[model samples]
Target: MNSTTAVTAASPPTRSIRWALASLSLSMLLSSLGTSIANVGLPTLAQVFDASFQQVQWVVLAYLLAITTLIVSVGRLGDLAGRRRLLLSGIGLFTVASALCGLAPSLELLIGARTLQGLGAAIMMALTLAFVGETVPKDRTGSAMGLLGTLSAIGTAMGPSLGGLLIGEFGWRGIFLITVPLGLLTLLLAQRYLPADQQQAKNTQVAFDSVGTLLLALTLAAYALAMTLGRGQFGVLNLALILLAGVGAWVFVRVEQRVTEPLVRLAMFHDRQLTTRLIMSLLVATVMMGTLVVGPFYLSQALGLGAVEAGLVLSVGPLVAALTGVPAGRIADRFGARRMTLAGLLVIALGCLLLAVLPISFGVVDYIVPMVVITLGYAVFQTANNTLVMADVQAQQRGVVSGMLNLSRNLGLITGASALGAVFAAAGMRVTFVVALALIALACRCARRH
Candidate 1:
C-alpha cells in the first residue's frame, strides 16, 4: 500500500480515548492513595480520638476490610451493570466519602466514611483494569497495565510522605480532602469520555450468593480480629472468639463447595497451572504487604528516622516495582509466563533474604537495594500472574476468574500482614523477615512446578 493509502486506512485517535485513559489512571492513583495515605495520619487520628494503638490501627484496617469484602462483588457487578457506568458511580461515591471523612468530627464518623470510601475504591479498582482490557487494543494492553501499575506504586510510595506533609501543615483531615479535587476531576472526565457500555446492564441477571458472601466476610473479619488480638492483651472471651472464627472458616469452605454460584469457584483448584499462578499472586502480595508494614517500624525503631523519612525509604520497593512493571510485562509477553514467573519468585526470595540479614547500622542504601530487587520481582510476578489467569478461561467465565484472582490477592495481603505482624510481635523484626523469606522460597518452589 502507498503511504497515502496506508495513512487513510489507519484508525484515527480521538480526544475521548486520551481522556478515558487519563481518567482511569487517576482513578487507580486515587484508589491506591486512599490505602496508604492514611498511614502517616494514624498518630494524629489517635490523638484526636484519644484512641489506643489497636483502635488507631483500624483507620487502615477498616479500609482494607471494606476493599477485600467488596472487590469481587463489585467486579461481578461491573460485568453485569456495565463497567464504565460502575466506574463513574464509584468515582463519585469515593469523592463524596472523601469529603465526609474530611468533615468527620469523631472517630466513629471517620471510620464510617473510610468504610464507604473502601466501597467506592472497590468499584474503581475492579473496573479500572478490566475496562482497559476491554477498551484498549491487544498491543496496548501491556503498556496500559504497566502505566496503571506505575501509578499505583507512586500513589502507595507517596502516601505516607504526602500524608505526613498534609497532616503536618493542615492536619489529618487534609489527607481525605486532598483526594476530593482529584476525584472530582476524574469523575467529570469519566462521564464525558468513557464510552457507553458494550453490554447493557438490564440484559444481565447476576444472582449474588448472599449467604456465601456473608460467610466469607465473617471469615475474614474473624481471622483479622483474631490475628490482631493474638499479639495483644486479650481475655478468655477473645480466645473463644478466635476459636469460633477458626470453625467459621472451615464452614465457609464447606458452604462454598455446595453453592452453585460459589463466592470462590472450588473447581479452579483442579487446574494446577492456574492454581499455582493464583497461589503465587496471593503469597507475593502477602509478603509485600507484611514487609511494607514492618519495614517502617524497624526503620523508625532501629535507625531513628522520623515518620516521613521512614516512609520515603520504605517506598523504594513500590517505586522500583512501578518503574520496572511495564518492561516486565513486555518481557513476560515475549518470553513464556512460566519462566518469568519462576524468575520473579526467585528474585523476591533474594530480596526477602537480604532483608532478613541486614545489620543494625545499615541505612537507606541497605533498605532500597533489597526493596528494589523484590519490587522488580513483584512487577514481573503480577503481570505474569494476571496474564496466566486470563489465558485459558472462556470469555463468559472472565468475571468469575477475575473475581477469584482479586479476592486471592486481597485476602493474601490481609492474612499475610496480620500473621506476620503477630510473628514480628513474638520473634522480633529479624525473625519476621526470615519467615517471609521462607514463604517466598516456598512460593518459588510452587511456581517451578508450573
Candidate 2:
C-alpha cells in the first residue's frame, strides 16, 4: 500500500482516535510523573534509608539517567520491532518497576528499580509522540500534540504536590504505588485503542545497531553525569566526563558513517528544517529550565518570599503551560505551525525581557505575570514545533525522530540546570534572566531563518 492508503487504513474512527489519544496522553503523563514525583520524597527517603543526601539523590538520578541514555535506543527499537508491542511492554515494565520501587528494602534496591522505571518511561516518552502520526488525522495533529503537552505539564505541575500528599498520608512508598493502577489503566487503553503496527517486507528489515546504541548511551550518560554531579560545581571529574562525552560523540558519529544499519542516520541532520527545530527545541528547553533553576532563588532572595510562597509562585509556570496547551494546539491548527512557532518564541523573549527589567518593588505579581506569558508561549511553541516536525516525518522514521526531539529537550534541560543555575549563583536574578532572553532571541532567530 502507498503511504496515504496505509495512513488512511491505520487511522481509526473519530471515537477510537480520541481513545487512542487518551492512552498516549496517559503515557506522557506517567513518564513525566516519574520524573518529578521522586524529587519531593528525597529527604524522606534519606531519613528512611539512613543514607546520606548524595546516596538518596540516586533515586532521582537513576531514573533520569536511564531515560536519557535509553530513550533514543528504545525509539529505534520500536521502529525496528513494533511501537505498539514495545509501548505495551514499556507500560508493563513501568508498572512492575513502580511496584518493585515501593517494595524495595534498601536504597540501592530502590535506585535499581527506579532505573527500570526510567527505561520504561523512556520508551513511553519516545513512542507516544511517534504514535501521534499513526493515530491522528493530519489536520488535527497540532490539537493532539497540544493535548499530550497538556498532560505532560499537568504531570509535572501536580507531581510535587501529589507526591507530598502521598508521602504524608502513606509514606514514600505510596508515591510509587499510586501509579500502578494508572499504569494498568493506560496499558489497557493503549492495547484496545492504539492501531496495530504495520507490517514491513522481510527483505526490508534492518538489524539493530548495537554498537551505535551502546556508544550513544554511554556518551549521553557521561554528559548527563558531567552536568549533574557535584551539585553544579564543575570540578576535575566533571571536566573529564565532559571530555569523555565529547570523544564518545565523535566516535559514535564515525561509527554511524561506517555502519550498514546505524542507530541514527547522520544524514538526517542535513535537513535544515529538522536541524533548526532540534536546535530551537534545545535552546527553548534550556531557557525554560532557567525558570525552574532561578525562579526559586529570585522569589526567596530578591522578592523575599518564604519557601511555601516561593513554591506556590513557581507552580504558576507549569499551571499556565497546562492550561494553555490545548488552546495553543488549536491555534497552531488555525494558523501555520511555523508562524505560531515564531510567535511563541517572541512571546517567551518578551517575558524574559520583562523579568529582567521589572523592579523588585513590584513584588510577586511581576514574576507571576511574566512567567504566565513565558509558559503560555512555551505551550504554543512546543505544540506547533512538534506538529511542524512530526507532520513531515517519513512514516518509517517517526519513532527515531521523536526520540531525537525528546533527547534535545532533555539535553537542554540538563544544560540549563547546570549552566543557567551557575549564572544565577554568580550574577543574580536579573543577569540570569538576561541570559535567558538572549537564548530565546537566538531561538527566535533560528525559527525565522527556518
On lDDT, the leading prediction is: 2
Residue 436 alpha-carbon offset, candidate 1, angstroms: 1.9
Model 1 regions more than 4 Å off: 1-17, 229-246, 257-260, 304-309, 357-364, 391-395
- Give lDDT tens digits, candidate 1, residues 389-412: 765554344455666677788878
lDDT of 1 at 18: 68
TM-score of each: 0.87, 0.98
TM-score of candidate 1 versus the correct structure, residues matched by position: 0.87
Tens digit of per-residue lDDT, candidate 2, span 320-370: 989999999999999988999999999999999999999988999889999
The CA lDDT of each predicted structure is: 0.78, 0.93
